[model samples]
Target: MTTKVFTIQPNKRLRAVEEIMKWAHVRHVPVVDERGRLVGIVSHRDLMGAAISTLQVRISEVERLQHNAAVEVRQLMHFPTATIGPDERVQRAAHLMRSLKIGCLPVLEDQHLVGIVTEADLLHIVEELPDASLALRI
Candidate 1:
């Protein structure tokens, strides 16, 4: 189970997204509604993809256009989120991530965001566990 997740609102603009990514140094973030329900996820990949596409259309035009300085979180977020309950087994979380092709999940209790689990977090667990690096059966 994961907890202590970071999030943003949907409809946020890309420039604001950059600040959060830069300040937080996070690769991904969950999007949530006003009610705090999970909605979508935004990853560094998503931001970079958007940035690249924006540039590809017309590099000069993009360069001339200034991104919004006061963009809200909602303006630049992804939707249709993937989430899992906090009590679910770690294996279940792993399965959801694998099937969804996502690296993270917003842990929820009822409809509220609670914790977050990521692929790296899972790996860290293994690394911290007793003899987790070993390849042995007892």
Candidate 2:
């Protein structure tokens, strides 16, 4: 089903990202600037990547903070984000994900971030072949 989706603005601080993750229980957030233009995408892993290498911060402190920790989202986000349009078929999404080695796709319409689709979304579509045992000739 085609639909619009979650988005965040660039002016929003890192703490906002943390809160969004907590409230929505989502791994990624699409970033739009003040003008409603998509600028980047941030994921939980991206935050973790930064947290892991924070030299001054004790590693234990990061672990203790857990998912609730609020850091600057922009500090950990990936820019020039990859995107797909809503009209695109699921197959294209799968192909792009595999080829690009990415975990999620931000659906866009007219350069605006729309719904997000991940590998998990596609997994539900996999169907078993009927009579697979009979077709097998090992």
Candidate 3:
């Protein structure tokens, strides 16, 4: 799990979110409220969907920037998101992500956003196992 997670506010523009994602090299970002409570989640897939919807035509970079600026994080974020506790086993996090068809799970502690577990994190665990080949076999 990533303890030093990057977060965004609901009122922020999608362009800001995109910039953060690019700068941080992260695909998933948690949304927090004024009190720093977890509110929603945003992913690369959400950004792509928003881009496709807004740029139906081949638009210039300036036009794309304008559209992104007009859209807020709340408009594309997944609210009331599924979350996991920090104390929970990694297997539980993996199961929840798989069952929910989500790419990541926000880690909460005492109702506060503490960290995040992503598909890449799980893959890293698999990669570190002594018998990783066996685990990967169908």
**How many pairs of residues collide in each model?**
11, 2, 0
Better of 1 and 2 by lDDT: 1
Rank order (by TM-score, best first): 3, 1, 2
Off by over 4 Å in 2: 1-4, 52-71, 127-138
TM-score of 1: 0.76
Off-target runs (Cα >4 Å) in candidate 1 are 53-65, 68-76, 136-138
Give the 10-residue window scoring lowest on summed lDDT in candidate 2.
Answer: 127-136
**Per-residue CA lDDT of candidate 2, range 1-138, in tens?**
234445677656666776687787777778878776778888877766655444755567556456334455566678744688989998899999899888788887888766788776776555433455345466
Report the lDDT tens digits of candidate 1 across residue range 81-110.
Answer: 577787888889888889988878878788
Report the lDDT of model 1 for residue 127: 78
| Every candidate's CA RMSD | 3.8, 4.7, 1.9
- Misplaced by over 4 Å in model 3 are 52-55, 132-135
lDDT of candidate 2 at residue 30, scale 0 to 100: 80
lDDT of 3 by residue, 1-138 (tens): 989999999999999999999999999989999999999999999999888454468778888899999999999999745899999999999999999898999998998999999999998998887874655456
Evaluated with TM-score, which candidate comes out highest? Answer: 3
